[model samples]
Target: MKTNESEYDRLLHDIYETIDNPCAWKDFCSHLRESVGAASVHLFGFDRQRDLFSWSDGFGLANAEPLERIRPLYRDDVRLSWLRAFPAGKWLHCGVELDCADDDDAGGTTGFALYPVADGHRCVALCKLVDHQRLTVILACSAQADDAPLAPAARALLERLTPHLSRAVRLYARRFALNADALAARKRAPAMLVSAQGEVLHSNEPAQQLLRATSLVRVRNRRLALTAPHHARLLEDIAVSEARLRSRANGAQAAAARFRALRIVGEKGEAARDASPDGASSASGQHEVLYAFYNVVVTPDDASAAELRAYAALTFYHPRSAPPVDEKVLAAAFDLSPAECRIALLLAEGLALKEIAAQVGVQHDTVRKQLQSIFQKTATRRQPELLRLLLNLPGGSAGAAPDAG
Candidate 1:
């Protein structure tokens, strides 16, 4: 419980190190509990809108207890009511929301008597809403531990730590995004993290934006999923094999694995399904959970103690579908209208007339008329001829196919 300049500086400085080494969370949680004399201290993440727990820590609690076992209690826990209504980074009572302290539900949320106590100790929580990473700090008293609220001294110490915690999360998130994007840039493919079960742990902005481009990939049940069975099977097999290898391989061994998820899709979402899976057609649009993504294993290195590491990183190795087309350049080169330029690019990408129409949200006849106009402007009366001309134009490599420059 000692507070000093050295102690404060020490934790503040290690925030980046913790992000690089998640196991640091264990140490921090243990330190916080020791400082506050709580029965148990937990840092919980939430989607307050749904009152769901995104993540929870195993500190001063039953390590073997699964989230489902505690979910019922957490849902009814009164902290949620306030969490849903509280503004960003606001320290709240963890008790009630909108004067609804008196409202009772099954999840043990009693006014002033927050339900999820540790052996009859009051559980206190404070929340900081940092965009999608809403985090809450929960403190519970043990029958033998401190039953009173956090002492002013303890509160003051925490007041110093909270802002640092939020900044760390944001920094961690940004770093993750940059890393994922770098992978995508290098492989020329969208990159994401999936659990051994293929549940998507994370994806970059490009990956999310690609979701609508094709049904081959999707995020469902908070997991990265696939609608195309062929790709799913391939991903599962690769993920499983890689997971096993990574779990056993050392850093050098993993680096030599030469592992990649091949031909998942061209252009992230721009290409047609490369192969169909057996049994179910993608046309049904049914999503199946992809099991096999994470390749976690304990490894030791001289640089530090034993730590968790991903044995394998997943990536798509394929030719990009197309580069973004510069509509203005194409139009200027071909002396075509903006609408004509868009249709020409889609046509060159090998999309059928119907597909192009669907992508552009236009009627079949509308696409036909546009095609005719484009042909007259460019002196090409057939689809193939127009596609060839469009492909040859500058800035015709790839794009969303701007309807206008």
Candidate 2:
């Protein structure tokens, strides 16, 4: 009795793990077959919509070809009838004799047990073969039974396992429903995922082409690069507007603020560029705001705007180039004296310091000192870094590298 108890405990633990990781049901089925010393074991899940029973796993059966053959008998015709008869939440166990008279070996008779899985309108069955006094379990999502009665021990185990098994099925169903809903939403509204930073993350075919020709080209670092800076500015304005809207208590104030921001973005494309010839700058353009109709509400206490903003930033900026250096970095690194910066344009043209001195009307030594200072300040010991820094300036590359002393 102690050994049987130990085995039962082990089986229950295995079952719990299997529920946690549904992918391991096959292994659980094999373990269950061995634990029960059964001739065959199978696990099946029912698809009510498709009206089919699929094999979750099976073990210790010759070829396992007959499992599918028996499924319809248990699931479709017989099981459905049984569920209709027993509408209440209850445990069911039954044994059945199979007619094998036509077979060459003629085993003559076989016995089986049936267990029902029911949650309101949903129902399924688990079946086990009971022959030669050994119990071989197979899970079936069916509602069928034969005339034979269950053994006392088998009845007790079914009673204990039913609640846990039903809960697992309900959890699985809920997850499946959620995934289906998400998929449907993605198909219906792909553009809602676009970041507040005016970078298009996903779009339909038409929107994709429109974005590509305008400011939506991807950066070298793989972020959606806004060629038109106003797009980014528009996003910033939207963020501010959203913040303001959140502060207003009344719907009228929120609506007015939303309209103001909408009109600003609608009249001027990001960067104040006029909308395309087709009036794409208008709110009626290819992109439309879905959130405008809804009132701004604060998230749950556990949620933070900072965390959400981080995710938004991730979508707009490439992970590698995030938090770009500010203009202070350029000012400090280039050691560019204001006057030298104004007059030393010739140095970037690859001119000799003497020629730059002549252009600036300064002594050659003075020009040389300015060039050295420029190199040191810009964090570039060499002229190439200076050249690169100049090239990357907001405007244009000032010129070529200056000659070394």
**What clash count goes with each model?**
14, 13
Model 2 root-mean-square deviation: 23.6
Cα lDDT of model 1 overall?
0.52
Error of 1 at 76 (Å): 3.8
Off by over 4 Å in 2: 1-3, 61-67, 74-80, 83-151, 174-405
RMSD of each predicted structure: 19.4, 23.6
Candidate topping TM-score: 1
Candidate 2, residue 396: lDDT? 19
- Cα-based TM-score, every candidate: 0.35, 0.29
lDDT of 2 by residue, 284-394 (tens): 224321111111222222334353221121122111112222244345446566755743355455677677778778887887777777766666676677666664453
lDDT value, residue 251 of candidate 1: 57
What's model 1's lDDT at 8? 66
